[model samples]
Target: MNTLLKSQLWRGLLLAICLPGVAMAASIQALNYSSREVDYIAVENPGNTNSGGGGDSIRPYGQGGSICCFTVPEKWHADLKVVVVYQLSPDPTFHRETVSVPQYPDGKAGDIWLIVYEDGSVGAVVSLYGPSRPEWPGKIKGYPVPTKEYRDERRKQKLKREKASLLTVERGLLLRGNSLPDEKVKEIQEIIEFQKKVIQSLEGNP
Candidate 1:
C-alpha cells in the first residue's frame, strides 16, 4: 500500500481495537424548549449493520431499535426512516410516530431527537417532517403507536390512505368536470398534490 493507504489502515485497526463503540456510538436527546435545556440519553448498542444487510445504507428497524452515529454517521446527508415513541402528555399511554430525517446542518454530533411531551412524556407526534426542521417536533398529541412494529404498520396504513385518497379525488374531479366550484376544486387539488407526494415517497422503500 502507498503511504496514505497504510496510514489509514493503521487508524482503522487502532479504532477497532482501542475504541470499538466510538464507531457505533449515537446520541439521543430530549428537547425542552420552554425550559431551554437539552437533555441527553444514553442508548443501548446492538452493533451497527448496513441497511438491508446489503449495500443499501438505510437500516430498517424491522420491529424497533436505536440508531446512532455508528449506523448513520455525522455529515450523512441521506434521510433516515425512524420512529419517535413517547406518551401523550398527561395521558400515561404510549404512542409511536414514524418520520424520515437526515442529519441537520446545525445538529450536534450523534444527536437523535427523542420526542418528549410538554408534561415530560416521551415522543407523541405522528407526523412526517420536511428537511428544513430535521429536529423532532415537540409536544404534539396524537393516537398511540406502541412499538416499532406498530409504527411500521401505521406507516403502511398511511400510504394506503394516501393511495385511496388520490383515487377518490381523481374520480371526483373526473365526474364533476368543470361544474365544481372553484373553492371545492382547489381543496381537492391540494389534497391530490399532497397524496402524490406521500405515495411517491413510499415508492422509494419496500
Candidate 2:
C-alpha cells in the first residue's frame, strides 16, 4: 500500500478502538437521581388557617401518602413530575406538576421550588422551606404540625444514631465551588433543554 493509504488505515483503526471507550466514559459521567417514595400531607387551601375536614370546601386535602421523590446531587440536574390526586364527589381531580431543579449555586443546595400547573398551564411557584426556615406558607394554625425545630432535632438524632447511613454516594464530591467537567456540564444543560421540551409537549404548547 502507498504511504498515504497506510496512514489513513492506521487512523481509522485507532478511532475504531477509542470510540467505544469514549462512549462508555460519557455514560459513566452522566448523573442520575434515584426515585424515592416519600409521604407528604397535601393540604388544600394551603392558605387556610384552620385544619378542617380533609376535603375541598374547608381543609380539603388528603393525609400523608406515598409519592415518588427525586433527589438530585449537587452539580447535577433533575426533572421530576409530582402527581397529586384529589378525591372528590363526581370525579377525582389529578394534578401533575413538573419541577426542574438544577443543583448549582451551592448556597441553594437545600432550596426546593414547586411549580404548580392548572390544566397544563403554569399557575404558581411555591418555594418549599427546609429545616432552617422560620415558617412555611399555608401552615395550619392551632394544629400539631411538624415544625422545622422538630425536623432538625430528629435529623440530628438520626445522624448520630446512624452515621454510616448519613453518608451519601456523592457526599464529599458535592462541596461548595465543586463543579463538573465542562463537557459534562454542557451535556447536563442539553438534558435540561430536552426536559423543557418534554414539559412543553405535555402541556400541548408549540
Candidate 3:
C-alpha cells in the first residue's frame, strides 16, 4: 500500500474506534481500497429509536423507488441512527430498527444508507444504486435509484399524473366559462401537446 492510502485508512480506523456507538465497523476495509474520500462508503445498523430521534427521516419523495436516505451536511463525526418502521405485514405492528455510519467531514462527501426491509429491520444499506441517476439528477447522490431501463417508465407515469391533473382543472374552467389569463391558457396548451407526444413515444409510435 502507498503512504497516502495507509494514512487515510488509519484515519478512518481511528475515527471508528473513537466513535462511541458504531455497531460493526472493525477495519476500514472500504477506505483502504478507495482512491478518494467519496469512494469510502460504510454501513452499520445502529438499532431502532421508536421515538424517531438522532437523524433525519427521509421518506420517498413520491417520484420513484422504495428507499429513503438521510444525510447530515456538516460532517461525519458520530453514528447517526434512523428508525425504520415496516408498515405492511400480517402482524399489527411491524419491526422497528436502526442503523448508522461513522461521521464524514463535509469535505469528504460521505453518505449514510438506510434500508427498510421486509422483516422490519432498518440497517446500513450498500451502494448498489448504480452510476447514473436521472430521476433526481444532481440533488441526490450516493443513493439507490431505479435502472435506466426503468427511468422511461417512471417518466411516463409522472407525465400521466400531470396530464390527469391538468385535464381536471381544464374541465372545471370549461364548465364555469372562466377566462384564464393569456399566459395560463398558453401554458395549458403546451402541456397538452407535451403529454400527447410523451404518450406516442412510450407506445413506440415514433
Candidate 4:
C-alpha cells in the first residue's frame, strides 16, 4: 500500500478502537429519601438492555449500592426517558413512574441515580457524586428526618443484632473457658456476667 494510504488506514483503526471507550457505562443506583423502606427499585428502558438495573432492601434515606453496566449518551435528547419501578416495604403491589433522563453536567454522563422521594414520587439524575456528598444532584437535601417510629424500629433492630452478637461471643468464651486455668476461667465467667447484664439492659429489664 502507498505510504499515505497506510497512514490513513492506521488512523481509522485507532479511532474505531477508541470510539467504544468514549461511550462510557454508568452504574445504576437507588437512593431512598422516603420514610418507608424500598423493597425493590429498578430502571428500565424499552429495547435497551444496557439501561436496565435494579436493587433491593434500600432503607429510608439510604443508598442500596450500585448495579453496574448502564450507559447514558453524552448528548441529551427529547425522547430519552426511563421507567422506574419500585415497591415499598409492606406493600406487595409494585408501582412505576416514567421519568425523563435529566441532562448530565458538562454534557457528560456519570452514574445514574433513581431517587425515591418522601411523597412516593420518583426522580432521576445523573451525577458522579453520591447522596452523601454535597454535590449530589438530587433535589432532596441531606436525608429523611428520622420519625419517632423509625427511630424506635432501628433501635429494636440494633438491640436484636447486638444481643445475637453477644450470645455468639458468650458461646465462644464458654468453649474456651473449659480449657483455661482456674483464674482464667474465673475471669471469663466475670466477662460473661457483664455480657448478660448488657443483654438484659438491651431487653429493657431493670
Would you estimate the TM-scores of all the predictions?
A: 0.28, 0.20, 0.34, 0.61
Candidate 1 regions exceeding 4 Å error are 1-23, 33-71, 106-108, 115-206
User: What value of lDDT does candidate 2 attain over all alpha carbons?
Assistant: 0.31
Residue ranges of candidate 4 with Cα displaced over 4 Å:
1-23, 46-51, 143-149, 156-206
Clashes of each: 3, 3, 7, 0
The candidate that wins on TM-score is 4
RMSD of each: 17.5, 27.4, 13.9, 7.4
Per-residue lDDT of 1-206 in model 4, one digit per residue for the tens? 99999999978755553465355566787778778889988887755646567655688877777687455655666677877888998888887788887666555667888888878899888877665677766787665566677777777887787778778877877678677799977887787687777767767731
lDDT of each: 0.45, 0.31, 0.40, 0.74
lDDT per residue for candidate 3 within 1-206, as digits (tens), equals 99999999989865754465442232111111111112112232344243231222222221112222332323344554544443322334444545554333222332334433222334442232321433211223434444454456566776677677768756755764457777777777776677677656665621
Kindly state the number of residue pairs that clash in model 3: 7
Q: Write the per-residue lDDT of candidate 2 for residues 36-132, one digit (tens) a residue.
A: 1112212222333242121122111212222222222223334422222233233345433333433333322222222211122211112234322
Kindly indicate the candidate among 1 and 2 with the higher TM-score.
Answer: 1
Greater TM-score among 1 and 3 belongs to 3
As for lDDT, the candidate ahead, 1 or 4, is 4
List, residue by residue over 1-206, the lDDT tens digit for candidate 1. Answer: 79999999978865663353343333343333221121232222223222211111111211112333323333433544455444332345444445555444444334454443334433312123411354533333332224556456667988888898899889989899599899998998888898898899886655
Single out the weakest 10-residue window by summed lDDT for candidate 1: 54-63
Better of 1 and 3 by lDDT: 1
